[model samples]
Target chain A: MSTTTLLLLLVLVGVLTYLYRYAMIGLFASRSLPAWLHALCRHIAPASFAALTASGLFVAGGEVVFAFDTPRPWAALAAVLVAWRTRNVLATIGAGMAALYLLKLLFPT
Target chain B: MVQIPTSAGGEFLAGCRDEAPLLLGVAPFGMIYGIAALAAGVPAWVAQLASAIVFAGAAQLVIVQMLAAGAGFIPIALTSGLLNLRHVLYSASMAEYVRHLPRRWRLLLAYVLTDEAYAVAVLRYQQRHAAAADHAEHTDSGTPAADATADLRHWYFLGAGFTLWAGWQLSTAAGLLFGATIPPEWELDFAVPLTFIALLTLLLRERAGQAAALVAGLGALAFAALPYKLGLVAAIVLGLAAGAWAVRRLGPVR
Candidate 1:
């Protein structure tokens, strides 16, 4: 994309994103959400996060490969374990990154 | 009558203080975005502008990749918006505490609303509400409304937002300038997935969240071959469906 096009796209994306976030809060202000809707909202973060994380972790070159040789799945497991145990975001990220680099060195895949 | 906090500035500063650790966690991702935007051939000014304009790490990264691949503008913009739609839900959740603020303040707050800020703000609000409830039972009706506490929470959110916004802009600019110097073999790309993993781990602190994450992961894996990022769409739908189902079946936890 040309610079102008990229700039336009960036601005459009920014406005749309800000509106998506802002509109709901603006519209729903001072109104209590129904219990069911509130309950559904609780899932939004986890679900979206999971979708984003999983797509990055397992998909490679438009295919799914679940193999021990790939560092992602294993490193993710390590990260999850550390996170669950310590409930620490930084530690979990560090452990996962460390595992990936170590696996890369040992296996070279 | 409610007594507003005497030190909105101080409260905002303290909120920033609480968010310092999360800011650190987010900075590397911002730096990675900067580097990746440059690698994707976005112009230095455009790349930095994307950070300034979009101010969202994940959506900006997705937009950069799509633009590099020659995706149409409308599709790229829509996808970016869709990816960030979850923020709407966050806003809805956080609206209750900030609803009483003036319209101008609410509008500005909405602009700066983000995942980290929402998380910290809601937690603080809940804490304040609980304290108020505890005090209400023993106190007489003459006590003032607890607006000061709410003001403090709002200030905290401002600190968090300001810190995040500054870090994001500076890092993107740095990446645009210094990105080409870094070798490809450094595998900085891996950091993106690692960051998400860390975020997911932090999120799955409860059974419903854990279940939703598992469903999303498995769904994404199952539909990984879908074209045009359809797998991602499927993963989101399935994950949310799974989470909603879990809540329906088991009810809210705590």
Candidate 2:
């Protein structure tokens, strides 16, 4: 792609993406959401983060790899335990990364 | 323990401080993005600019991938848009918290919004809400003092957004300039998922929350093959439905 083309794509997608990010916030700013929508909103964080976490741990190259050879799932398990127990973001990330490196060392694949 | 700030400056600083830990994952991911964008033949400047302008990490990465494959303009735009559709949900969830702000502030926040920033900001907002609820429980009349302090929470959101933005720009540049310094063996990208897992755990205190997360996580895996990242959207929708159903079945928790 030419520089001009790349620049154009950047601006085009940037605007489009911004619209998505701004849509609900901008349009619904004045009006209060109905009760059901409010209830749905409460679950957004959990649902979005959970799906993101699962895909990040399990999916590789567009495929959902369920094999045990990779250290991600175990690392994620460690992170989950730390998060559940400590509720500390720093500790949870530390535990997960430590678990990953250790498992990689112990079981190189 | 760090105190939650009541004033705007304090809240902003608190936002930056709270977000600092996540940078361990984010910085590496940004560098990886820069390196990948370079590898995909994105001009160094354009890659850096895209980091600033698009600001959506996964979608930016997808755009680079599509560019490498010689995809045309419309396809790239549409795919990026589709992948970012999830932001609409984030925007909706956040609308109530940020609605009281001025239009300029709302626009500014919307621009800097990303999954990482949203996660951190939403957590802070929820903490404030929880604290307020607890205060109301104890006091005969709700404290206007607490309400007044909470209104400045957007400053905290701005602080977190700015930190993530600055880190992303610097990391992208670093990746382009010193791509070889970071080893692929370290698998720095894995930290991103770990960050998400940590966040997911924090959000799963209630049974309904847990049910939503479980269904959504499983649903994402099940729908992983869907094109244009629709699987993520589908999983989130399913997860929300699951959460609502659990609430209905179990009755609302006090």
How accurate locally, in lDDT, is each candidate?
0.71, 0.78
Put down candidate 1 lDDT per residue, B1-254, tens digits, no spaces: 22324477876776676667777767777777877777677777777777877888878776655544445666566556666776777777777677766678777788778877777777767776776777778765323234443445667667777876777777777766667788866666555566666667677767877788789778877887766566666776677788878876887788
Q: Candidate 2: TM of chain A?
A: 0.68
lDDT of 1 by residue, A58-83 (tens): 66656776666677788888887887
Q: Each prediction's Cα RMSD?
A: 4.6, 7.0
Alpha-carbon interface RMSD of model 2?
Answer: 5.1
lDDT at B150, model 2: 49
- Count of clashing residue pairs in every prediction: 2, 0
How well does candidate 2 score on lDDT at residue A71?
83
Residue A102 CA error for candidate 2 (Å)?
Answer: 2.2
Would candidate 2 be rated incorrect, acceptable, medium or high by CAPRI criteria?
acceptable
Per-residue lDDT value at B235 in model 1: 70
Question: What is each candidate's fraction of native interface contacts (fnat)?
Answer: 0.70, 0.77
Evaluating just chain A, the predictions reach TM-scores of 0.72, 0.68
Model 2 CA lDDT for position A82: 90
